[model samples]
Target: MQVSIVGSGYVGTTIAACFADLGHEVVNIDIDEDIVETINSGTPPIHEDGLPELVGKHAGQDGTGRLRATTDYDSIFATDATFLCLPTPQADDGSIDLSVMETGATQLGKTLEATEDWHTVVVKSTVIPGTTEDVITPILEEESEKTAGEHFGVGMNPEFLREGTAVHDFLNPDKIVLGADDDRALADMHDIFEPLVTKSDAPVVEPDTRTAEMIKYANNSFLAAKVSLINDIGNICKEYGIDAYEVADAIGLDDRISEQFLRSGVGWGGSCFGKDVAAISAAAREREYDPAMLRAAVEVNDRQPNRLLSLMDDHVDVSGERVAVLGLAFKPGTDDIRNSRAIPVIEGLQERNADIVAYDPVAAENMRERYPNISYASNPAAVLDGAAAALIVTDWEEITELDAEFDAMTTPVVIDGRRAIDRRDGIVYEGLTW
Candidate 1:
């Protein structure tokens, strides 16, 4: 299958490379000249594990001629299928702003008007339930002046790829959903994913377009709620002088609860969980439905950073001291700090007028854009030098391996939000949730 992916962001670039690797001729279409040029020159525009190797192998001058990128929307007409991986960024009121995606769809439809070939359009970006069928398909039909089912096939196939492990997750997906309004569109989707399915042996779910969109939201919502629930439990365990990990481990033995998202800490902070949860909760409220549990889960997530800061306050006064912050990325293996728990932790430290120095080998540059005044260290040990208190926000391996670095701190008071470091003898250690 010839696959043309629109919007060469994280999802677009990743899937394009993976599709090419899966033996499909792929062309990624984006408006950004820099991204298109980067991909054309055999490099990835964004940071992701295993992405460079994949892009290098299939694109550019030295690689196979299976994958490439272009800035023209007309490029989609040359392909048999197009996946809309454009952004659906969140609005201030928690609803997703679909203006960007709508513009892309309109352009795709205009370019698609010239093609007589039966093309399948798949919505791979995360959107609300009726977005694909109602918003996208209507725009496509209007711009192209062609009927949806008869002229062009429409489908909704949401992506579940995580930030750090996008390549691994795409190649080894838990489930593959193929959604379509018609049989031809569904069959085309199967043809596109058949090779991947045969290799991974993942289950295939056939559903309508609306159900597929809802699945993405529901999946993230459940995991976000689970994390908050565990954090909530951890808070209670702390009040009663209990080890939250022990309680979590015992409960994890049950098949129903499982062990995933059981590690309770500062809270989940990334592009997906918080955005998806908020969007879905707002969507529910728009229908006059009060999703109390979901809203409460968000509230718990919001307060966890303050809770971690309060723990640090009990150990020492950091107002006039050098406070070292370890790990600024939302998680390990990525440079994204969009909604990192470290943001709130840093904000709390700022409120108290703590002289801050933070370290994350990969994400320091990105965080520098957010906090130019604060000091950034070249290494974790450097960040801990002469610090009064150290706050662990991300559980990066380098931050976790600091057994004796605490001795460098003036106060030697360590407050861990992610339990990155263990409690040792030489330093006063505090774990946010044990």
Candidate 2:
């Protein structure tokens, strides 16, 4: 099967590579000239484990003539299946700004309108319920002048990928969900993914489009809520001087709440949890329903950054103080900083008039782009130089090497946001809520 992935993001690139590895012809379309050029030269634009290797292998002469990269819309229409992996960024009002997704779909519609060949449009981006038939299909019909399932079929196949583990997750997905009203569309998608699923023994579920959409939100919301719940428990334990890690250990043994996203920390950041939870809460409110639990979960997570700030304020006066933040990205595995807590925590300190110095092993390059006012350091120790206190927001392994060095400081104060540091002594270490 020939597949065209419309967006060359983390999800899109991995999907294209994985499909190409399975002997399917995959063309990735992107507007970025640099990215398209990079991929055309048998290199991935972004970093991920096993991605560059797979992309290089399949895109190069060794594996398949199947994988290719392009910016041409004509190339996109040439495929039998077009996968929408575009971004559905959030607006300020918390509603998902489907502008990018809609624009891509509309463009695809125009292409399909002019094309003579039949094709199936699959949405691999995360979207709210009813987006497929209600929002997406209408645009396709209006632009294409043909009804869906009559001329071109449609389906919603949302991606579930972690940034660091995207390639592994794609090659060995827990499940492959296909949601389409048209049997032909579903069968086509099944054929495309059948080999990979069979090889990995992954489950292939054929749920309704709306159910499939809801599943993505439900899964992310549950994980976000669980993390928030654990953080809230950590906050409560902080008041009573109880170790949240110990408490989590006992709770995790219950089999009901196994140890995933249960770590008490400065809260979740990155692209998915924060935006998805807010968008979902907003979507629920629009439908005349209140998702109180989800709302609270978002609230707790939002407050997490400030909580770390308050913990830092406890150690020393941040006003006119030199403070070093050890990590900038939301997590250790990637350089994505869409909604990183480190941003807010740093901003919160800045509001208090602290002289900020920030460092991250890999994310510093991107963080420097996002924040120009803050001081950029060469290493963790460089950030800690002449600083009154250091905050460990992200638990990158390099930050742990400083545990002994930080302990030797004359006035060392380390605030662990993710509770990644605990046993280091001599330095004034404060774990936010733990």
Candidate 3:
């Protein structure tokens, strides 16, 4: 199968690389010349685990001449399938702005108009419901002057790859969902992903395009709900003098609950959860549905970063005090800081006039680049010197393994935002929502 991915971001890169590894010819398309050049030069555009090595191994290989990068619109017409992996950023009204998808669809439509061969365009980017048929299809049809499902079919195939382990998740997906009414489009998809399905029992669902588009939002919101629910429980436990970690452990033992995303922390911060939940709730409101619970989840998740600041104030006055922040990324194992809780936490402390020094194993460069005013030291210990308080925002393993003596601190205070640190004597230890 020859596929053209229309974005070179995290999802696009991983999708292109995975398909190429599976023996399919893939041309990853992007408008940026630097990104295209880096990919063509056998370098990864984004910093991800095992992605650089994977791209290095297959980027220029002739046998797997499968994987290539380009900025040309002519390549879109040559591929058997065009996967739209463009960004659908959140709008001011909290709804997903589909302008990027619209642009991609319009460009592909122009390519379709100029070409003679047929192709299937799959919406792999996370989009609002009905986008494939209601929004994108119309543009593609209007620009190309061709009927969908006959000349060039359209489908909704969302990607579900976690940032840290995206490559592994892409190859071994939980399921392969293809939403298309056109038989030829469905057949083309089955032929492309057949090897993956044949290797294991992967369910393939063929729902309406709207249903498929909604599934991505629903799935991410549900996971975000789980995180917020646990954090809410943790907050209740904090007020009632109980350990939220223990409560979660007990709840996780239940066969029905299943302990994924139950870890309580400063809250979820990434490109997906924040945007998806907000967009879904806003969309629901537009459709006359009162998504109170979903909105509450978003509120609780938003308040988590400030909760850490309040915890700091309750324990000690951070004004004019030296503080050491242990982590800067939204989570461990990735340098991505989009909507990270650390931002508010750092800003809140700074507003209190605290002298802050932060350290993150992988995210220091990004943190420094984003917040140059704040001091980003080389190591955790370097940031801890003469600090009155130590706060952990990201649950990086090295911070938990830190053997620094608490007696060396001016105040000996440690606040765990992710509950990563255990209780220790001689040091005043407090955890967020714990």
Candidate 4:
């Protein structure tokens, strides 16, 4: 299979490397020259586990040269399939802004205008239902001046890769979803994923294009809601002096309520959950349907940070005091801080007029772009020194072993959001939902 992926962001780069590793010739096309060069140099543009090794094995001068990156849209003409991995960022009104996808589709259509061989364009990016058939198909048809199913095929193959473990997830997926109306498009998708399916022995889900699109949104929205529900239950458990983890453990014994997404803390904040939930909610509203439970999930998640802040306030007066934030990334293993809970925690501390010192193992640089005013410490101990209280937002592996760092703090008050710390002898530890 010859695969061309548009956009060299996290999903794009990861998939391109994985495809090449699967013995498919892959070319990643992106507008960023630096990203293209980096991919061609056998280094991943983004930080992901096991990605560099795969990219290095198949790309670059020393490798097989099966995987390479280019900025030219014309490169798609040579590939049998092009995956549109562009970003669908949320607009101000909560609907997805598909301008990036639209532009990519237009350019792809123009590039395929002169080609006679049948090509398949797969929508790998998450979008609202009806977007593929209604929005993207028309743009491609208009630009190419060719019938979609006859001349070119379109398919919707939603990715189920999670950050921090994208390579493992891709290779060992739970299920493979193939969405297309036409037989040719469906066969092409199956052919592309045949290697993965045989290797992973994952279930294959064959749905219509719209259903596949909805599957991605529904999948993310449900996980977000589950986290919020656990957080809500965790909040109530805290009021009655109960350990939420214990409750989660017992409930997880039930076959229906699984153990995943049960750990409640400051709530989920990443590129997928918040944006997908918001987009789906907006889509539901557009059809004159109110998604009340989804809206409540957002409310519960939003209030969790304040609840953590209030717990901190109960122990110490942070006004005109120094506070250390232990983690900045949404979750450990990556430096992405799109909708991290630490943002609200920091903002709440700012409203209290506290001098903040933040620390993250790898996400400080990214968070610094959003908050350049806050002081960032190189290590956890540095952040704790002279600080009145500390809040743990992310559960980095290094944080779980910080037993002696509290001794340096002015006040050894710890409010753990992810339960990533222990209640040391000298430290007053307060778990968000314990």
Weakest lDDT window of 10 consecutive positions for candidate 3: 57-66
Candidate 4 TM-score, C-alpha based: 0.99
State the C-alpha lDDT per candidate: 0.93, 0.86, 0.86, 0.93
- The positional error of residue 228 in candidate 4, measured at the CA in angstroms, is 0.6
lDDT (Cα, 0-100) at 320 in candidate 3: 88
Better-scoring candidate (TM-score), 3 or 4: 4
Residue 318, model 1: lDDT of 91
lDDT of 2 by residue, 99-143 (tens): 998899888889888887889999889999999979999999999
* lDDT, model 1: 0.93
TM-score of candidate 1 relative to the true fold: 0.99
| Residue 47 lDDT, candidate 3, scale 0-100 | 79
Residue-level lDDT tens digits of model 4 in 186-243: 9999999999999999999999999999999989989999999999999999999999
- True-vs-predicted CA distance for residue 224, candidate 4, Å: 0.8
Off by over 4 Å in 4: none
Q: Would you give me the overall lDDT of model 4? A: 0.93
Top candidate when judged by lDDT against the true structure: 4
Residue 392 local lDDT, model 1: 92
- CA shift at 265, candidate 3, in angstroms? 1.7
The regions of model 2 sitting more than 4 angstroms off are 60-63
In Å, residue 94's CA in model 4 sits off its true spot by 0.6
Prediction 2 TM-score vs. true: 0.96
The lDDT of model 3 is 0.86
Model 1 poorest ten-residue lDDT run: 71-80
